[model samples]
Every structure is written in C-alpha cells, then in structure tokens.
Target: TKKALIIGSGIAGIAAAIRLAVKGFDVEVFEGNSYPGGKLSEIQLGEYRFDAGPSLFTLPEQVDAVFQLAGKEPKEYFAYDKLDVTCQYFWEDGTSLKAYADLNRFAKEVQSKLGEAELSIHEALRQSAFIYNSLAPLFMNRSLHRFDTWTNPLALKSYLRMGKLGIFSTMNEANQKQFTHPKLIQLFNRYATYNGSNPYETPATLNIIPHLEFNIGAFFPKKGMHDITQSLFKLSEELGVNYHFGQKVERVLVEAGVAKGIRAKGEDHYADLVVNNMDMVNAYKTILKDQRQPKLLLKQAKSSSALIFYWGVKRDFPELDLHNIFFSDNYPLEFEHIFKRGTIYEDPTIYLNITSTHKNDDAPAGCMNWFTMINVPNNQGQDWDQMIAEAKRNIIHKLNRILKTDVESLIEVEEILDPRTIESKTSSAQGALYGNSSNNKFAAFLRHANYSSSIKNLYFCGGSVHPGGGIPLCLLSAKIMTEMVEG
Candidate 1:
C-alpha cells in the first residue's frame, strides 16, 4: 500500500484521510492545531460553546458520502435535518423577511414583503437551477483540468451550455435585472456573501448558491456545528488513520523534483504522496521553499475576512431564529468599504447566528449563543484594535435599534475573533476566509488547482483551491484529489 502524508487536519484533510484509507492506503494527517477541523472548530468560554468558524452547515450529502465510502452507515456517524426557515433578514428600512425552505412559501414572502414579480422570481429560480445543473458535472465535482472531460459526451454537452449558464455577468446585476424591487434584489444578492465575494462584482454563476440552500436545502446538525468535526474525527480514527497533533510542517520535502513528504517540528518524515490542506499562500511561501514560486498563484486577490463577536447571552429573544441578518443602510457602500476602501463603516450590517434555538446546550438554560459576525476588509496593515473596539460599539447600537433592546448588557460571556487572529490561527492568508475573493468574473477559472501542473505529487485542498471554498467544495477537493491520484 502507498503511504500518504497530509499537512493540516482541516475538514478536507480528514476527508482525504478517510478516502485514502478506504482505498487501502496508509494515511497520516499532520495538523498544526491539537484538534482537527481547522477553522471549522469550536471554543469554550466558561459555560458557553462557540463554533469558532463557519457557523452555517449546508449540504450534508457531501459529508455523508465520506462515511459511506468508509463502509459505514452515514446516519450512524452524522445526521442533520433540513431547515424550514433558512434565515431571517432585517433591512435598515424596517422591513423584515423570513427565507423559508419551501419555495412557494418563500415566493409568497417575497411577493408580499417586497411586492416582487412572482413570475420573474420563479423564472429566475428555474434558471438558477438550470445553471447549477449544467455546471455541477463539469465545473465542480470533477477535475476541470483533465483533458478527458473535453472528450466525454456528457461533459461536452455541459461545455456547450456553459456560455448560457451566466458566468460572465455580476450577481447583483443579474438579480437586479431579473427583478424590479430593491429589497428583492438585495435578498438574492446576499447569496454572493456565501463564498465571501462581493455581490456587486462576483459573477452571476454564484447565483447557484441560493439554489443550493433554498432549492436544494440548508441543514442544521442535531448537535452544535463542531459536532461535525467530533463525529468525522471519530470515524477517521476508527478507520485507522494516523493523526499527528500540533505538528506544523515547515517544509514540503521534495527529493529530485518529486514530493517525498514534509518537515514538521524539526523532524523529517518521508511518504510517497503529500496533500496540503494548509492555506495556499502559506503553503507556497513556506513549504515549497526550494521550488520556483508561482507568482501568478501568489498574486490572486484574497477574500474578505470577518470580525466576529461570540456572546453567551443571558436572555433569549423569541423573535430571533437560528440564522439572522441585519442589513446596513447601504449594501453597495458596505461592500465598497470592505473591498475598495479597506475599512469598517459606522453603519456596518451585522449577521447574527443563534444556535441555541435549535440545540439548547449551546448556551446555558434560558439563554442563547449569539455568533455575531460582520464582513471586513482583509488584513492590509490596519489598526484592528481601534477598529474592533469602535465596531463593537457600533454593532451594539445597531442591534439595539433593530431588535429594539439594549444589546450589550445581556451577555454572560463574550469573545472576539478578528482578522489578525483568524490569520494567525488558521494560516488563512491575510485572514481571508475563502482563500481568494471572487470579485472578478474570472475567479472561478483562476482558483489554484488541486494538483499543480508544475509540482508532481504535491496537491492543494481546503478553502484555497478549486472548485472553491466552504464545506461542500472542500469535501469535493478530497474526492477530486483521490480520483486524480487513483486514476
């Protein structure tokens, strides 16, 4: 059996370990963090449990497939129920809408609240489904760089429909053109943020995101989101995958232009293959030191980082749902503040994820765990301490205005995660959450490849590579790498 050495124990690393082990390969995962899950981890503050990263859980099938491939019943290891209400939205104009899981209910909500054209909304949704269906087999869930896809009849048919799939126009532009209402456009436009891209600039192809959540479904784990890591780690270990904790790799060992293994903690361990779940920027700069750096790969734009305030509130709000968003006065201006101006605005919108509504243990009895986050500019040498302090005051004031309560006094415990800390903890370059920003339409084709054309046996995964970030794409990265290696 071939031996594989993986750097970083992110979700994709664990998935890769499981897949490789199922293929009868000897697998070892080396992680910088003592625990697995990387950014998708958790922290305890007194009695409160805070999901450290990625508050939302969508597309459980990607995770279940991993357990199934390992010859185990998926439900035995992981289970999640579809959400009836996807999210609750609050605009600055005193209008609110609940994004329902059922299309008819959601359409009714949109039509009643925004006075949107139901026919236009329905047609646009059908088009979104069409685009997602056409691109899924070609762009995602497979190796886009492979020559054989060009030859396959199924792939070729998809290739022909690619032009009509709407990848060239911006998401906001398409949604605005599809509907005549401002709030409705704003509602659909919010999907761009799912990948940490600006709706104003990111291509309309990203409209596929709403289809994934609303049309397909969004899920909530029976336990907290971190339970996802706990269960998967248990499954991977049960499959006999060797895991090295708190071992940060300094160099990717390349002997004669081929990957041998990695150098971590002043010790060199050799293996036949290496998979890096570390952020691409750090991996390229640190691990592949002797190799000629891919300047093009290094230069891709980074996604917006976030500033999060995790609070263990002493009071529960009956009006709030599991997921909520409070819009800023100006959506376009807010994006410009993050991406163009590189600063936080006084009127910054806030996203609140209260998981205690679903799982009571996230907070103490009678209280809620509030995962409050706001998209901010990636690290560019700003005064984050001052900025964060000021932003906290603004957030408290804004939430008070919208939710109609004194926001700050209800906390039993609180902690903040900033861009600087996110970068330090996860090695996500500039603290960007989703590798590179999709501000440009060409971003889809520009994401770093899973396996380099130049570097043999050295591959990239997790949030930094194609077909892009978030849980489903990260899982697909593992599947794509396994297939590429096995083939």
Candidate 2:
C-alpha cells in the first residue's frame, strides 16, 4: 500500500487522511498538540466549556459529506440542526434586529425595524445567490491556477456572468450603492471580515458570504462546535488512519526536489506522499528550509487576527442567542484601525457567541459561556500586551452598556486568546485567522494551489492554501488536494 504522511490534525488534515485512506493509501497524521483539532479544539475554564475557535457553523453539508464518502451515515456519526435565529444584531443607537432563518420573515423584520425597503433586502439576497452560484464552481471547487479549470464548462458560464460579481468595486462601495440606510450597508459590508479583509478594500465579490448564512442557513451541531472535530477525527480513525500526538514535524524531507517524507523529533518517516496542513508561510520558513521558497506568496498581506475572551458568566441573559453582534457606531473607522493603523479600534464591532444557549451542559446551571471576539490586525510587532488590556476594557464597557448588565462582575472565569497565542498554538504565521486577506480582486488567484508546482508528491491542505479559510473552505481544500493527488 502507498504510504501518505500528513503534517497536522486540523479539520483539513483529518479530512485529507480519510480521503486518502478511501483511495487505498495507508495514512498517518502527526499532530504537534497532544490532542486533535488545531483551532477547532475546545477549552475548559472552571465549570464552563468553550469552543476555542470557530464558533459559527455554516455549510455543515461539507462536514456531512466526509462521512458519507467513507460509506457511513453522517447523522449516525454526527448531527446538527438548522438555526431558526441566525444571529441577533445590535447597534449602538439602541436598535436591534433578529436575523431570522426564513428569508421573507427576515426581510419583514428588516423593514419593520430598520425602516429599509423589504424589496431591497430581497434584491440583495437574489444577487448574492447569483454570485455564489456563478463563481463557486470555478473559484472554490477547482484549482484556480490550473488551465483546465478556466477552460471547463463551469468556468465558461462564470466568465459570462462575471459582471454581476462586482469584482471592480469594493464591498463597502457596492453596499453603500445598494442601501440608503447606513446600518443596512454596514450589515452587508461586515461580510468582508468573514475572510478577515477590510470592507473598504476587499472586492464586493465577497458579498456572496451572506448567502451561506442567510440562504443556505446557519446550523449548530447537536453536541457543540467541538463535536465537529471529534466526529471527523473518529471517522478518520475508523478508516484505519493512524495519528501521532505531541509529534512536531521539524523538517519536510526533500530529495532532488521531490517530497520524500518528514523528519519529526529527530526521526525520518518516509512516505509516498507528504501533505502539509500547517500554515503555508510557516511550512516554508520552518520546515522546508533548504528548498526554494515562494517569497511573494509568503509576503502577501495577511488576514486579520482576533482577540477572544472566554468568559464564564455567573448568569445567563434571556436576550442573548447562540450568535450575537454588537455594532460599533463608526464602522469605517473600526476597519481603518485594524487594516491601516495596525491596531484595534476602541469602539470595535464585538461578536459574542454563547454555546450554552443551545447545549445547556456547556456551562453550569444558570450561567453561560461567552466567546467574545473582536477583529484586529495580524501580528506586526505591535505592543500586544498593552493593546490586549485596552481592548478588553473597551469590550467590557460596550457589552455592559448594550446588555444593560455589569459584565465584568459576572465573569466567574476568564481566559484570553490573542494573536500572539493563536500563532503559538496553531503554528499560523502572524497568527492570521485566514492565510491572506481578500482585500484585492486578485486574491482569489493568488492563494497557493493545493499541489506544489516544483516538488513532486508534495501537497497542502488547510486555511493557508487554496479555496480559503473557514470550515467549509478548509474542507473543500482537502477535497481539492486529494483530487489532485488521485490524478
């Protein structure tokens, strides 16, 4: 049997392992951490359990398909339910909106609350769906660098409808043109940050993000977000994939410009193919030391990082849901601080995720676990200690003012994850959430392809490589990488 060695045990790595195993390759996954799930891991703070990263769940079918591909029923291994209320949005001006799962109901709610025309909402959604349908087949499912991708029928169709994608305008510009209401514009512009890009600079093609949440619908796993990692890891094991914990890969063994295997803890493990699930920048800088590095690709602008505060609250609020966003009074200035100033905005847009609302066992009785996060620039030698302290103060103040509660006093437990720590934990260069920012139109074509052009039997799968970040894209990266390998 052909042997395949995987470098990390993230969702993408595990998915790749399963795919390769199904393809008749003997698979072994080496994880630096003692446990599986790099960013998708969980944390225990006192009596509260928090999903350490990626709180929002969308495109669950991406996960379900993995198990189904392995000849198993997805529900039997993992299950999730579509969320009725996707998110609760709060503005600083005492205005709130509940984004209902139903399209018509959400439009009516927007009309009644924001005084925006219901027709505008419907039209925007229609356009978003169109962009997703047109571009996803070419840009997301296939390798952008490959000539066959552009020559395919799907690519031909996408090229014909390219004008509707808004590739020429920025997200903010397109949104401002679409809606007269500042709040509605801000709401749509927020999608740029989904890939950690500034709304003012990122191409409006990112507007397709809203369709995934509002149209396809957001979902929550039955057990919790961490269950996604657990279920996939379980499936990989059942498919006869081996896992090595606490094993840090020190080098990618290259012989005559071909990937031979990996050197971990002073021992070389040979394989027929090597898949790096680590950050693309780190993989080049740290592991593939002697090989020719792609300096331009590594030097691309990184996506924004996050400062997350996991607070075990003493009490739960009735108004809060699984996902909630507190909008800043100045949206443009907030992005300016992150992207340009390389600092966090004082009045930052806050995202609060409470898993205890759905899974009662996540926190102790009458209490809740809050994963409060704010977008900040990727690490660039800033004074993070001072920045973290100040950002925490602002976040508490904003939450207190909007929720009508003394937030600081209710914190029974606290743990913070900043960009510095995120980098250290996940080996993500600059602690970027996504590999690179989609701030420019060429970002789609600029992402590193799944297979190495120069090295044979070498591949990459994860947020740092092709497709992009988030759960759905990472899963697709694995699928794309495995397809490249099979060919």
Candidate 3:
C-alpha cells in the first residue's frame, strides 16, 4: 500500500487522511499537540466546558459527506440539530432582533423590529443565494488555479453574470444599497467577519455568507463543535490511519522538486505523498523552508485574529441563545481599529456563544459557559498584554450596560485566548483566524493552491489554503487537495 504522511491533525488533515485511507493508502498523522483538532478543540473551565474554537456550526452536510464517502451512516456516528434562531442580536439602543432560520420569519422580524421592509430582507437574501450558487462552483468546490475549473460549463455560466456577482463593490456598499435601515445594513455587513474580513473593505461577493446561515440554515452539533474533530479522528483511526501526538514536523523532505516525506522528532519518515495542514505561511516559512515560496500569496494581508474570553458564568440569562451578537455603536471605526490602527476598539462588537444553551451538561445546572470573542488585528508586535486587559474591561462594561447585570461579578472562572496564544497553540500565521483577509476582490484567487505548484506530491489544506477558513471551507480544502493526489 502507498504510504501517506499528513502534517497536522486539524479537521482538514483528518479529513484528508480519511480520504487517503478510503483510497487504500497507509496514512500517518503527525500532530504537535497532545490531542487532535487544532482550532476546533474543546476546553474545560471548572464546571464549564467550552468549545475553544469555531463555535458556530454550519454546512453539516459536509461532515456527513465524509462519513458517507467511507460507506458509513453519518447519523450513527455524528448528529446535529438545525438552529431555529440562528442568532439573537442586541444593540446598545435597546433594539434587539432574532435571526430566525426561516427566511420569511426572519424578514418579518427585521421589518417589525428594525422597520425595514420585509421585501428588502427577501431581496438581499435572494442576491446572496444567487452569488453563492454562481460562485461556489468556480471559486469553492474546485481549484481556482486549475485551468479546467475556469473552462467548466458552470464557470462559463458564472462569467455571464459577473457584473451581478458583487465583485465590484464592498460588502458595506452592497448592504447599504440593499437596506434603508442602518441597523439592518449593519446586521448584513457583519457577515464579512465570518471569514475575518472587513465588510467595509472585503468584496461584496462575500454577501454569499448570509445564504449559508439564512437559507441553508445554521446547526449545532449534538455534542459540541469539538465532536467534529473527535468523530473524524476516530473514523480515520478506524480506517487504519496512525496518529503521532506531540510529534512536531520539522521539515518537508523534498528531492529535485518532489516531496519525499517529512522530518519529525529528529527522524525522517518517508511517504508516497505529503499533506500540510499547518497554516500556509508557517508551512512555507518552517516546513518547506528549502522550497521556493509563493511570495505574493504569502504577502497578502493577514486576516483578523480573535481575542476570546472563555468564562464560566455563575448565572444564565434566558434572553441569550446558542449564538448572540452585541453590536458596537460604531462598526466602521471598530474595523478601522482592527485592520488599520492595529488596536482594539473601546466598544467592540462582541460575539457571545454559549453551548450550554443547547447541551445542558456543558455547564453547571444553573450556570453557562461563555465563549466571548471580538475581532482583533493579527499579531504584528502590538502590545497584546495591554490590549487584552483593556479589551476585557470594555467587554465587561458593554455586557453590563446591555444585559443590565454586573458581568464582572458573574464570572466564576476565566480563560483567555488571544492572538499570541492562538499562534502558539494553533500555528496559524500571526494567529490569523483565516489565512488572508478577503479585503480585495482577488483574495479568492490569491489564496495558496491545494497542491504545490513547484513541488510534486506536496499538498496543502486547512483554513490557510484555498476555499478560505471556517469548518466547511477547511473540509472543502481537504477535498480539493486530495482530489489532486493519485492512488
């Protein structure tokens, strides 16, 4: 059997291993951490259990597809429930909205609360669906670097509607044009943060993000998000894939532009093919140091990182659900602080996710596990210690004002994940949540390809590579990467 070596046990790496195993290859996974799952792992804070990364779950069919590909019933191994209320939004002005999974219901909610016409919501979603349907085939499901992709009939069809695809405008511009209410526009513009980009700068083609939540629907894993990694890791092992924990891969062994294997723990392990699930920039800088680098792709602006405070709250509020967002008073200025000023905004938009809302066991009987986070600039030698301290004060102040409770007093335990720790823990380049910001329209094309252009048999997958970040896209990155591998 051909041997395959996967560097990193992230969701994408595990998925790639499963793919290779199904193709009858002997696969070995090397992870620096003691456990599998890079960002999609879990953490425990006293009596509270938090999904340490990527709290929101969507595109569940992508997870099911992997199990089905292995000829197993997905539900038997994994399961999740679609969220009826995808997210509850709160503004400082006492305005609140529930983003219902049903389009018509959500439209009604927007109209009733924000005073925007239901038709505006309907029209925005329709445009979102149109963009998603048109672009997914060309930009996502396949490799943008491949000539065959552009020549596909779907690509040709998409070309005919390029002008309508929102590529020319910013996400903010598109939202402003779509809605009259400032709050509604802000709500739609927030979707740009889904991939760690600024709505004010990211191309409006990202408007497709709303379709994933409002149209296809958002979901929550029956367990927590970490189950996504655990289940896939189990499946890979069941398929005879081996895993080496605490084995930090030092370098990719390449001879005459062909990948031989990798070096880890002072020994060389050879394989027929190699897959890199490390951040693309880190892979190029560390593992593939001897190889020619894709300078332009690596030089693109890094995506915004996150400052997460995992708190075990002593109290639970019924108003908040699985996902909730507290809007900042000045959205544009907030992004400006993150992207341009390289600092945290005083009134930053806060995303508070409590898995305990769905899985009662995640917290104590009357408590909750709060995964509170805010967008921040990726590590660039900024004073993180000062920033984290100030951000925490701001977060507590905002929560206290909006929830009408003393947030600082409610925290029974606390754990913080900042840009510095995120980089140290996950090996994401400068701790970027997504590899590169989609601030420019060409960012989709600028992302590193799944397969190395110069090195034969060396492949890349994960949030850092093609298809962009988030769970679904990382899975797609693996699919796209492995498709180029030969059995």
Candidates in order, TM-scores: namely 0.98, 0.99, 0.99
For candidate 2, lDDT tens digit of each residue in 127-236? Answer: 89999999988888988878999899998888888888999999999998888889999888998988899999998899999999999999999899999999999999
> Could you tell which candidate, 2 or 3, scores higher by lDDT?
3
lDDT of all predictions:
0.87, 0.93, 0.94
lDDT of 3 at 241: 94
For residues 29-75, what per-residue lDDT tens digits would candidate 3 score against the true structure? 99999999999999987789999989888899999999999999999
Q: List the residue pairs that clash in candidate 2.
A: none
Error of 1 at 276 (Å): 0.9
**Which of the predicted structures, 1 or 2, would earn the higher TM-score when compared with the native?**
2
- Model 1 RMSD in angstroms: 1.3
The C-alpha RMSD of each candidate to the native structure, in angstroms, is 1.3, 0.8, 0.7
Q: Could you tell me the C-alpha RMSD of candidate 3 in Å?
A: 0.7
Please count the clashing residue pairs in each candidate, in the order shown: 1, 0, 0
Candidate 1 backbone collisions, by pair: 303-437
